[model samples]
Target: MDIRPLRCRDFRILMTSGVVTMFGSFITIVAVPYQIMRLTDSYLAVGAIGVVELVPMVLGGLWGGALADAMDRRRVIVLCEIGMAVLAAGLLVNALLPDPAFWPLYICAGGIAALDGLQRPSLNALIPRLMKRDEMAAANAIQGMRWQIGSIAGPALGGLLVTQVGIAAAYAVDLATFVVSFVLLAWLRPAPAPPGAERPSIKGIVVGVRYAFSRQELMGTYVVDIAAMFFAMPMALFPFVADDLRSPSSLGLFYAATSVGALAISLTSGWVRHVHRHGTAVLIAAGVWGAAVVGFGLASDVATALVFLVVAGAADMVSGLFRQTMWNQTIPDELRGRLAGIELLSFSIGPTLGQMRAGGMAAAIGLRGSIVSGGLLCVGACGALARVLPRFTAYDERTSPHGRAETTEPVQPADPGQL
Candidate 1:
């Protein structure tokens, strides 16, 4: 299995867009919570904003996936990007107002989150069309790297900009990035819509959901991911941990440590081509992740917690690479958009619900206890998933049941109007 770098022109464009978008997104992540806190001075209201965003995000991905299957994916992505840009500009204007009401912010957050939901699936679907079959893992690794960078950079940068300048300045930066992303997307060629697709409707969404669940392997993967995220995720209680173990200022360091760990793994992912049994690798990674979470929960000092976080992040990066490759290769091209959407929805549910659960658990049992319980549950969940889906756990990447070759040569750039 030969792995190629994303040296293709369109892939380069997409990668550049990712860089800009991630930087801008980080700004918003920081600015939104800060602004909301400044306005209401209530932790409850700030927390409510997260819930407000999650609803639209899940729905948007579902609907967007259906639309991507029905229409040209490039068009779907471009439209979403444009909508995102408009929303960012609106946020900028709202920030400038003498007394920006909370309702408008909520509305904007929901809209942006919804648009992001659509953007993610469409983007994932488009990647396979951009690259060859064999390149999926490598492409996903690169994509993972982009996200790792964004996750690390976005929050810290947002905090700096918000603290030094203002929320408006951070938003302005986000708006600029949206524009750049849109321009790059515009330059890319369109991808073929899922064949035999009709107009977008509720029925179409249903069809997509059915198609996604029809596959045992894909369904199994979603189940495993959901279990991991729902039980192991401790992000919501990070603030509490920071307060307990260190100053608020040191919170960003923990985030950076996680990102650095993920980045280190992704940078060396080229060596991953040597691994024959991706499924086994995924399970090992998941187990390690669970152990790291347990360690993190018990850590009394910031350094110990950070060490656990880095390990968790590294394990997560490896799992993500294999999982994404499995998804891209297993699904048919026609169902890619819809399946990707369903997958995205499943992905969102676990983390969102987990965060909410973490918050409540922390309040009830103390941060360390809540985290420890979550970690234990995570290990149990993974074990349950493996036991229930033994066939899926034994699946090997060397042989795909799908008609397409298990591996293929690199893909060439498509004509702009081919889709």
Candidate 2:
């Protein structure tokens, strides 16, 4: 198959924005929980932050997705970035306050999450407009690579900055990244609204919801992803592992190992492009992820746990590649933003619910037992999805409906007047 990348100028701007945003986002992810821990010295308080963040993210994704479809996508992204920048500045101010209240931290985190909800779908919808039909896979691969690279660097850098410089310094770095991202986004021309787009309204939001749920393949992907995240999220247990199973230093080591594994797979972008049965690859990777989670739960030594985490990250990277490709390719340009919103909603809900469940189960049954049970259930869920969506297992990129390799011609640029 002949695959090329998006050559459009706006796509380059958006991709550059993604790199900066991901790095800053990762830094915040590391710094936030650590800051909460230091302030309250309570695990429940940290978990509460997750809950607060999830609510706004899910709500914003639905509304944002609808708005993206009805308005100019580039403008929507810029507005979202600006909101994020303001929130980051607020965090910096709060840090400097004489008595930084816990409630303020929670509010800032929720605000950031809401802004991200708006940002994610707009960006996902913009990719196809930038590329030829045949280049969707490669474009998605580049996105996956960018995410993994940011994930690899962000936490380590955040940790170093917080440990050496201070927590406030980490937030300042994040604030700076948002500034750079906003500047890049400002340079890009706006993406034209889809043909015949209507004025934005609540009815438009309902329409997007209706369109997204109507597609079988898209719905199937959502089902599988929700199932995977609900049963497999191990984030709630990280602190326990650091405190009980290993030293605090080992926590960073474990995260670094996982990032390295993901980075290794992402760097081999060429290899991912060649995979034919992408859906099957996703299923197989999910199974590996389950097994690795189980292995980590049972591991007695820090070395063994780190090894299992590396395996889990590798499996995660593979699964992410296929899942992203499936979503980006199957959705139509007109509905991509809303569908991406629905996708984000489903994605966020699962982990949010999972963390609550994990925390509760760990309290009742013990951390190891909770981890083991979740992993086992995840593996079983994958098998169940395979049986139900048997055709999904047979999906091949070469035979895509958008255009098979033999039938699809390169996209001629839209008329200069239209652009």
In lDDT terms, which candidate is top? Answer: 1
For residues 55-83, write the lDDT of model 1, one tens digit per residue: 89989998888887778777788888889
lDDT of 2 at 350: 79
How many pairs of residues in model 1 come into backbone collision? 1
Error of 1 at 340 (Å): 0.7
**TM-score of model number 2:** 0.89
Residue 292 of model 1: what lDDT? 91
lDDT for each of the candidates? 0.80, 0.78
lDDT of 2 by residue, 135-219 (tens): 7667776777678778878988988887788888888989999999988887766565677777766787778778756655556
Candidate 2 Cα lDDT to native: 0.78
Question: Which sections of candidate 1 miss by over 4 Å?
Answer: 1-3, 403-419
lDDT of predicted model 1: 0.80
